[model samples]
Target: MSKPVLTIFYQFNPWDSSIGGIQTVIRSFIKYAPDEFVVRVVGTGAPGSALGVWKWTEYAGKAIQFMPVIAVGEDNVRKLIPTTIAYGASLMRHNFASDFMHFHRIEPTLASLNWAGDKTLFIHNDIRKQMDRNLGGKAILWQQFPKVYFALEKLLISQFEQVYSCNSESAQHYREAYPELAPRVAFLKNGFDPESFYPDKREEREIKRRELAQELGLPETVRFLLFAGRLHPQKDPVLGIQAIAALADPQVHLLIAGAGELEEQVRREIQALNLGDRVTLLGAVNSDRLAQLYRAASAFLLSSVYEGLPVTVLEALACGTPVVTTDCGETPKLLSPDSGVVCKERTAEAIADALRRVLANPDLYSSEACVRTVQPYSAPSIVQEVYRQMLHRWQYRKAIAISSPYPS
Candidate 1:
């Protein structure tokens, strides 16, 4: 008997040049996907280097039948409509062959929802919450658009056979939106690559600390509080800076990594706040370098106003580094006496208080504890869970084939 086929549709190709937690999740998941399933991936916005006619290639040590859609230019809306049509056509052709299909981000889900097969929708964030947040600040048309969008979102979600939420909060939002479909909405959380992210030996960890200090021309005595993510509004990078300044501790240095439209704004605030000496901006660093910083830093920090579980926080926990984060996604659930701390209020003073407390007792949060808490969230464990769920669903459909199949 041959392995069952599982097709995945994603908004962006992980093979293409990209950054962020979503892309990282796709790449990492593919790397650890079970051999029990034959994998096929359909993605959009592939760079020229990755474009091929259904390329059969190996990436991250996994065999994948790859298909990518080319964009005309930089207009995302212009490219998106066509990408959806193209991928949707492919899904229709592969519908019979594939045992099931899974979608990564929203655009792909919306585009390929017409496929008549066992499919799962992965929800990265609450679209309604985002629209609610933006309506007040956007143009007049946008002010009235979110309410309309909320209705459309509910309708679209009702069409899906399954919806995968990364955290309990998101799951609750979906369950509330369509109580009738509550059982169809499932929780499959995000995690980290345990092999690549682990605590270094105490001496080696200190060496990386000294190395980072020397490379950045900083004093070895200073403690670095690391924050790695796109410098976007939702990330609340400015609030993170304000929180650091509130501490007013000269011995603590803040390291901000990742880049985005808000980079200039963050830079200006750094200058205005006289944080130039205490804050270091690292535009972007590869996974290995990021892991090094994780091991070297005193603690990781993220002040996002909202999120659907962040991969960065998981990476930090895997590196055995404590984190100080706003209460977004599963950060609150993941926190404990030995794991890290959270600022539920999302205020500078609240974050400062939490940071101060974590900094006050360095040894209270042990590296072993940090690693242990995140063990269940490792790549291998998550991969197994996804495989089991998809397989079980596939078998259930087969058993029900004799009866009138459930309507879409």
Candidate 2:
């Protein structure tokens, strides 16, 4: 007999891009899926033969497929709506063939909701709400957008046989926002690949450290503090820069490695603070380079005002680097006194203090302990749990039908 089909609808491609947490999660999922299920992914991209899809099919007897939806121009709005509708219509045609539809992000979930199919939706982040709040002075205009988006979120979630959230906070928010659907919501934390991110050997670490330092024109004595994510208003990279400035520790250098809409603004702030000599903005670093950076850094810092659950922190911990993060999203649950510092206040002073403390006392947490804490969050482990829960729910429903008096 053939394995069951599990179709995933995502607005973006993990293999084609290096965008933050979402891409990381999807790539890890593909890398570690079980052998009993066939995975097919549908994503959106630029129109025509110029656009191509990537497929990975090496997992035992399981198969993987990528179907791309081509768009017309640079303006995403012109492409998004039509591509989404087309994708949904196509999936509706094959509804009876698949066992389940799994949506990795919101837009696709909204698109797949009305289709005559069984589905599951994963709430990666409360992105629409985050965007509304981050838009600041334009909040009135964008705030209304989230209200509509959340309404759609609620509606789509209701249509799903099961809804999975990346963190407990999102689960609680969904429960509070829509009490009627609380029972269907389940928590499925994101995971990492230990082999890909685990600590490097001492020789490897030293070599990478020296090479990176020389390449970036850094003095051998300087200790680098790293932040790896988009420099957007939501991530608040300015806060990380300001925190370093507040410390006034010349030995501590800030290395930012990502891009976003606020790139120019972040550059302006660096110039204003006369931090050109102390900060290095590496634009965007690839996965291997990012892993090397994590191994070389004194600590990893995240200053986001909100998040679902950042995979970078897990990656950093897996690489044996301690983390200093704000109490954003599910971070507090992940951080213990043994792993890293979690700040209650979202200010430069608070972050600076946390960074200073972690730097001054690195041995307070054992790297091995930190790595062990995140073992349960590995990609294979998390995916296995997802499969178990899904199967259990399916069996329960089957049992109910078998016991019902009206059943054939």
Candidate 3:
């Protein structure tokens, strides 16, 4: 009789200011949710003040509630477990009225899976595997914790009523790791906001492009290649710089935006490659400026070896910019003959070839085709699918509850 209320549990990485794909999904669902449902977001705070809550209104239907828990110290395993458990209990008690609960990442709060009336966990990526893979060349301390984290994730996956992954790759990974729950996993594609990214006015685009180029000290004769995302090893930002180096075209410049732990390493690599003047490490450009960079660039490049579903590629296409990406995650699924190039390998030479081909013949891919390929990923369409499935499951559970007769 009454509309069900959906509560989302999301992780907040304070160091990251620009919203990521996972955060975008939470925001979209809240913004476009049907009138019948109520949506609330619960953000886990970064280490330090891990037990405070803040509320804010974001859009017409979505409300955000952020909780800060005491910060977990590095290598302090003794305190991590207790803090996670305490935070989970606090979150469960705070959102007691929610009819359904959705978690953005697999974390300690997932312990509440047993109490939430309806539960869904959206697997963005196999975090533990990533941590291990990316830490291969890093400090020994960083390598020790992924093993512990992976074990905890395996335990959490078993408790969910339903599991959703951003791409088929993630779904398969989960299925192989947890065969018992494979049948319950569903695929939910990531989407973009068309209103914010659709083709810009020609005059406006040109003017904005000029302004961006001037700000970045890019020359008018140079063709800009944009890579937008965290500057982390997992993203392979160094590979992007390597690709630009191989291009050896002084006329082409690579713009690396966003910051991360690998910043210093990437900078050293750029200099070693003799790309000091050619590669620009802009470091964490804001959303508005990022949109302008997308419009100005001759093409967008993604060097990630693994990803959930990169919303950046979709946003680039939505802005009518051709994209060049590796065959990582769902990138191949989103690309086509008209959109741009999709390479088979993550090597610098592979990416270099793709970039050369697109820049050589931009006429082959039209703005119309780029827009068409990314149309289904619009925020409204994707959110509608999420709501439909959630409501369907809720109804099925209600039916079962009514039919199951209590002991007489």
Candidate 4:
């Protein structure tokens, strides 16, 4: 018998490791897939005037096809409409010849409404909550559309054979939204690459911290409160700066490692708040550099208005750095008093208070304790379970196809 082929879809440059947590999870799935399965990855790229060809690539030493659809857009929201149409058109034109299709996020799933085969959806965030929080600016113009759009999206959700959420909180939310399909929803938490993120020795960490300060042009005595995510409305980069301003601690600095549409706005806020010396935007850094930042930082800060289980939180914990985040996603459940702090509110004051508690007693949240907290979420272990589940589903489908009296 041939190995079951699994086509994984995500509407972004999947090869770009710096994109965010979603890419990390996708890469993990590809990297740790079992020998009995063949996984193919599909992503979007600039329009090449014609459809691009599938190129076989070696990812984590496994041979797989890297297919790109010629669909381009400027930003996340803008990319949705074009990517959705492009994916639907691509599916219509090409036969992936796979036993199963796994989609990340809503757009691709929306495009696959006509697919009658074994398919699954990965929910990375609380969709309803995220839409509600991000419905501002020009989004207010089409405010009524989301109500009807998501109503249709709910119907789309019912079409999937299985749905995996990044956190239990989001899993529960989706279950409540679609009561009849509640049994199909499951929580599959995110994990960090243990090889890429881990605690550095005390002597080595101090040396790296000094080197980082010299590279970023900061004082040798400065302590970093790192924020690593896209500077979008979802992450609320401005809130992080506000929290830093509220802290009013000269020895502490906020280092933002990612950039997005809010870049100019973030710069303006830094200047307006007179936090130029206290805040540094490093733009986007690769996985190695990010791991170093996690090692050197005093604490990882996340001020998002909402989230699913954020991979940054897991990476920070894996790197032996405690996280100080607003109460969102699975932070409250994932973090313990000794490992990290979960803020009671989303306000700057609340975040500042949490930072104060972590910064004041650094020894209380020991590196060993922090690392211990996320050991259960090791990539190898988590991805193994993911592959096992996929194989089981594939086997069940095969059994049905073999026993059925009618053609599949």
Candidate 5:
């Protein structure tokens, strides 16, 4: 029998040009998908592409078809509506021959809610919590609009046959919030590519450490506390700097590996706190470099105010690096005493204290233990299971459609 066709829709292409956890997850899904299904992806195109134009390309070594909708607006809060309209129009006009439809984020989900097929929704985070934290300081309209939109989404989400969240806790919260739609919501942990992110040998670690020191123009003796994520309000990059300053330990340098809207603010704060030497903004780094940093660092840090299952945390653990994160999303569940530290508070003092403890007794958190904790989140196994479940559900729906006198 032929494999079933599955079409995935998202705001951004799952290629080198794009950078986000959802894009990574989508790439993993396609890369490790089982032989039972054929996957094709639809995403928004680059700005140069004309509106309503469709572009075809190959990415990530997948022979599977990649489609891009030429939507003009960029991915952000202000342009979400315009982008949604353009994307939805493109989706409506395009002819998709897939047996199943998958959506990665809210924009795509909203655009395709009425499309014909058994649909799946992948929730990357607790949208409500993220909005509250991201827009907490913004105007009343900025805060209130998302609330109304999400309220409507509560009704629209029921349209999806299966809804999965990266965080189990977030899944449970969603179920509790919409008991009528609880059966559709479940948790699927985020995963990392083991080949790209794994524990380094003793000698390998030493080599990478020296290389990293040379690349950053830092001394070999410096202990790196790595923070890898977008420099946004949600990520709270400022807190990482504050925590490092609070430590007041010159030897403990913080290496931030991503860039975003708050990059200028983060740099200003670093200089203002006189942490120019202690804090280094490496800007946006590739996965290979990030994995090397993970293997070389004393510990990984995440100071996000809220999150789902952060892919960075998984990648860090996969590289056998101990994580020091705030109590957000499903991080507490992922962290154990022997593996990492979950800060009790989100303040600079709390993060500094946790970092101090982890750095002081580095042996307490063994690399093996850290690697073991994240073994269950390997991309191949997790992606295989997702394929199996999605196929089963799709087959069941096909059976029902064939049996029923009415059209599905």
Candidate 6:
């Protein structure tokens, strides 16, 4: 039999310039997609770009078709429903059909409105919590019609075939909040390309560390605590800076990588706190460079106020760098005595205390042990599981569709 067609509404550009944890996960999926299905991705171009033929774009060395829809608004609250319909319209001419559909970082109802009900919505963050936090607090629920948007979110979750939560915390949240929809929920943690982020040899790691120190005009002896993610309120980059300032040890330096709306605020805080000498803002390095930064770090730190499984933490663990992160998402599931520390709370004091504790005993987090902790989450394994989960759920749909031959 021919492989089942698996059309995905992936929500972002698959181009090399794309950034963020979601983009990282999508790229990995495209790279090691199971042979059980043929794939097609439908997504959007950067905001304000013109809408045109974006289909037939090559990604991860695969010549898969990609439909890049351009929408007018930034919030995407008003545009999502129409945007998905338009993309589906574009694909219909090509006789694009699938056994099932996939939606990532989105509430699938709108996008999958014109398609099959056999959908898998991958929850990347707590959307409801983010919205409650609001724009000032940096939650993304700024809709022209708040009530309608929320209603749509609710409808999508209740109607989709499955919800693959990005972490156990997310899975548990969904279960407790929406008991009726709990049966379809499951954890699907983020992963890394082990080959790219693997641990370096002893001498190699040190040499790269010293080289990076020289590049940043810092001493080779200074140990780094790396923080990579958006400088948004949700990621809590400001909290990370505050924690850095609160640390008692002068050798515990922080390397910030990423650009976001709060760049100006982050700069002002660093200046006000007089952390100029200790905090280095590298500002969004590429994947290869990020891997090097992971090796150079004494430990990785994420002070996110909320998260769904952070890809940065996954990469750090895969790179064999111990983590000292806030108690959020999959930290408890992923961390170990051999891997690194988890702060008891989100307070700057607690973060500083955790940093000091890790700094004092660096040997407790060896390269091998850190790598060993994340072996199960390699890209190949994660992709295979995704296939298995989707395939298992799609079986029910096939049984009905073969007899009905109906449209979504």
Choose the strongest candidate by lDDT: 4
Any residue pairs clashing in model 1, and if so which? none
Residue 313 displacement in candidate 4 (angstroms): 0.5
**RMSD vs true structure, all candidates:** 4.1, 4.1, 4.5, 2.6, 2.9, 4.3
Question: Which lDDT tens digits does candidate 4 get at residues 1-408?
Answer: 789888888766654544568888988888888899888887776656234577777887888877876565443333334455566566656655467888886655655676556788898876656667343333222234677767767768877878999878779888998889898999988889988999987678778888888887888988888999887777888999999999999989899999776889999999999999999998878788899999999999998877888899999999999999988888789898899999888889999999999989989998989998999889889989878887888788789989999998
Q: What are the per-residue Cα lDDT tens digits for candidate 6 across 287-354?
A: 88899999988889898876778888889988888898887767767888879888877789999888
TM-scores for the candidates: 0.86, 0.85, 0.83, 0.91, 0.90, 0.85
User: Model 3 over residues 208-315: C-alpha lDDT tens digits?
Assistant: 667767786877667789999877655788999999988889988888877766788899998899999898888777566777788888899998867778888888
For candidate 1, the per-residue lDDT at 80 reads 22
User: Model 2 segments beyond 4 Å from truth?
Assistant: 46-63, 71-97, 126-144, 201-204, 391-408
lDDT for model 2 comes to: 0.73
| lDDT per model vs. reference | 0.75, 0.73, 0.73, 0.81, 0.80, 0.75
Q: Rank the candidates by TM-score, best first.
A: 4, 5, 1, 6, 2, 3
lDDT of 3: 0.73
Candidate 5 similarity to native, TM-score: 0.90
lDDT of 1 by residue, 222-335 (tens): 888999987766687899999888989988899987876577889999898899999998876778888989999889998887777888988998998998988777778877
Cα lDDT tens digits, model 5, 218-269, are 8888888999987777788899899999999988889998876677889899
Model 6 spans with C-alpha error above 4 angstroms: 46-54, 71-97, 127-136, 142-150, 176-180, 389-408
Greater TM-score among 1 and 2 belongs to 1
- lDDT per residue as tens, model 2, 289-309: 788889888789999877788
**Clash counts for all predictions:** 0, 1, 9, 0, 0, 1
Scored by TM-score, the top model is: 4
Clashing pairs in 3: 47-71, 48-71, 49-69, 50-68, 50-69, 50-70, 51-68, 51-69, 258-284
True-structure lDDT of candidate 4: 0.81
